[model samples]
Target: MPTFNQAYWEERYKNDQAQWDTGTVTPPIKEYIDQLSDKTKRILVPGAGNGHEFEYLVTQDFKNAVMLDIAKEPLANVAKRLPELDAARLIHADFFEHNATYDLIIEQTFFCALSPELRDAYMTKAHSLLAPGGKIAGLLFDFPLTEQGPPFGGSREEYIALFGNLFKITMLHRAYNSIKPRAERELFFIFEKK
Candidate 1:
């Protein structure tokens, strides 16, 4: 198992080992964003490597969007790509230690990239970061949990068990519009903070 710390991710970006980057906003997430009527909602995209979703959010006029990552490289890439984005919103910080609250947090590859031991911590942190009635939404890789990953795999049952206590599982189902490579392997979810 890898340490999966900031240095590990920084090295991955420096070496161009970010195989998880899709170079475009994911369809399921894009559709979800499209349905959102509040363009002013405070949004956070943690572990936002390359920030394609952040780009989409900005393009859609979500001015309060914040993009965070433990590694500086990806944030720098996003800054370069979207030069108009406010530099302050491109936060380079450890997600676990991040303290601000948000109305919505967009999850992409962030959850799977953490060590499985941090799953509970991730949920707790996410819960803490959301205001009451706020939501944490986006895709979760739906596969069996195993020891072989930075891109760790997990199942729907595990997710419900893991997050159900602190959040209302508003939507947790197989995503019908995932990018082809992720096809049937993802679940689009909306977990409202309880």
Candidate 2:
């Protein structure tokens, strides 16, 4: 397996191989934000390639939203397009190494991009980053797990067992509004930290 280090990701952006980017926020995440009454919640969007979801958050008047990416390219692209975003909010660092607290954390395509062994650490970091009763919500790929992916996959049963220890699975089901290409392959989840 190739080491999915910073260089690998930077190369993916530099070479324009980011097939996972949908160019806009997915419908489920958009709908989730649309219903949220709090425009001031502190939000973090980790591994935010091109930052479309975070962009959507800002457009909805969410004041404290931020997006972090391990690679510079996507963050730079976001910066170029959205100059209103605070420079400090567009972080370029390893996700595990990030240290902060938030009311909500967004999971776009980040989880599946990680090395499978880091799943436990991802959960721990996410939990640590959340304030009391805060939530981590968004899409998770639902498919067979195999060695052939940066967009690696996992089943719903596995997600429940993996996240149940530290988070209450408030909602975990197939996203009804997933883009056509991702239709039955994604699960929309709301996992509140316990």
Candidate 3:
């Protein structure tokens, strides 16, 4: 398997090959944010390439939001784009090594970007990082899983099996608001820590 580590990602950024970036906050996540009533809950967006989600959160008056990535380029781009947000909240680090807790941990393309062997580690770390009843909400691809991608795909059943023991699966179905190319290839899910 190809390494999906910092060097691998950083090279992708350096070479401008990040095709996974949608260039804006994804619609389903935006819809999810629109229904949230609390602005004080801590939120984390790991592997936040280009940081559109965190930018949307900050602009919508969410007081505590963090954007993290192993690659510095995207974080630098985010800083330039969101000059008003505190620099301390833009973390450049590995998600596995990150040590902060949050009330909500947002996922985007980060999970699929890792080697499949690390899925359990990702699950365990996500559980550890969240406070009691904390949630993880976002899109996961719903296609065949093959060895050919950072955008690795899986099915709803796999996701349910992966997370059901540690979380309450509040929502997991096809996303109605995905952008054009991703329209039928993703699942919008919310799993609250149990």
Candidate 4:
């Protein structure tokens, strides 16, 4: 099994092997952000590599938002682009160990990048980090669970099974607005804490 540790991810960035990074916020997430009426919601984009979505939130005036990542390189990259951003908003911490509450957690490439073994843990941590009735919204990779990945794939059944207990599945369907490369493979979902 690939060791999905901090060092492992740090090296992926150093080696420029982070192909999952689209270098900009993708359409599905942008649409989700566009629909959000509450600008002051405390939002988190954990494992937010390069943090383009976080950057987008900043541009849209989402002041109460933060992006956390285990790798400093990506966070540093985000900082370079948004130089005026508050330094504290770019958090360098492990997601599971990080302490805070948020009204919304944006999921993009983050979940698939985690080891399959950590799926349940990710779900539990997300539940804990959210405020009451808080939401976790974004895309999840929709494919067969296979060994060949840091970009591990999972089926719809798997997601329903894993998140069902702690979250109310408000939306869990294949994304209609994915970019060319991601079009049939991403599920845009919104899960509200139970």
How far residue 176's Cα lies from its native spot in candidate 4, in Å, is 0.9
Give the per-residue lDDT digits (tens) of candidate 2, residues 53-129: 99999788898999999899999999998887789889999989999999999999999999789999999999999
lDDT of each: 0.95, 0.94, 0.91, 0.95
User: Which window of 10 residues has the lowest lDDT sum in candidate 3?
Assistant: 1-10
TM-score of each: 0.98, 0.98, 0.98, 0.98
lDDT of 3: 0.91
Which stretches of model 4 miss by more than 4 angstroms? none
Residues 25-124 of candidate 1: C-alpha lDDT, one tens digit per residue: 9999999999999998999999999999999999999989999999999999999998877899999999999999899999999999899999999999
**Can you tell me which runs of candidate 3 are displaced by over 4 Å?**
none
| lDDT sort, best first | 1, 4, 2, 3
**Which whole-number lDDT from 0 to 100 does residue 90 have in model 1?**
96
Q: By lDDT, is 1 or 3 better?
A: 1
Q: Would you list the clashing residue pairs of candidate 3? A: none
Q: Could you give candidate 3's per-residue lDDT for residues 44-145 as a string of tens digits?
A: 999999889999999999989999999999999999998877899999999999998899988988888777778888988999899999999998999988
Give per-residue CA lDDT, model 4, range 1-194, as digits (tens): 86888899899999999999898999999999999989999999999998989999999999999999999999999999999999999999999999999999999989998888899999999999999999999999998888889789997889999999999999999999999999999999999999
Off by over 4 Å in 1: none
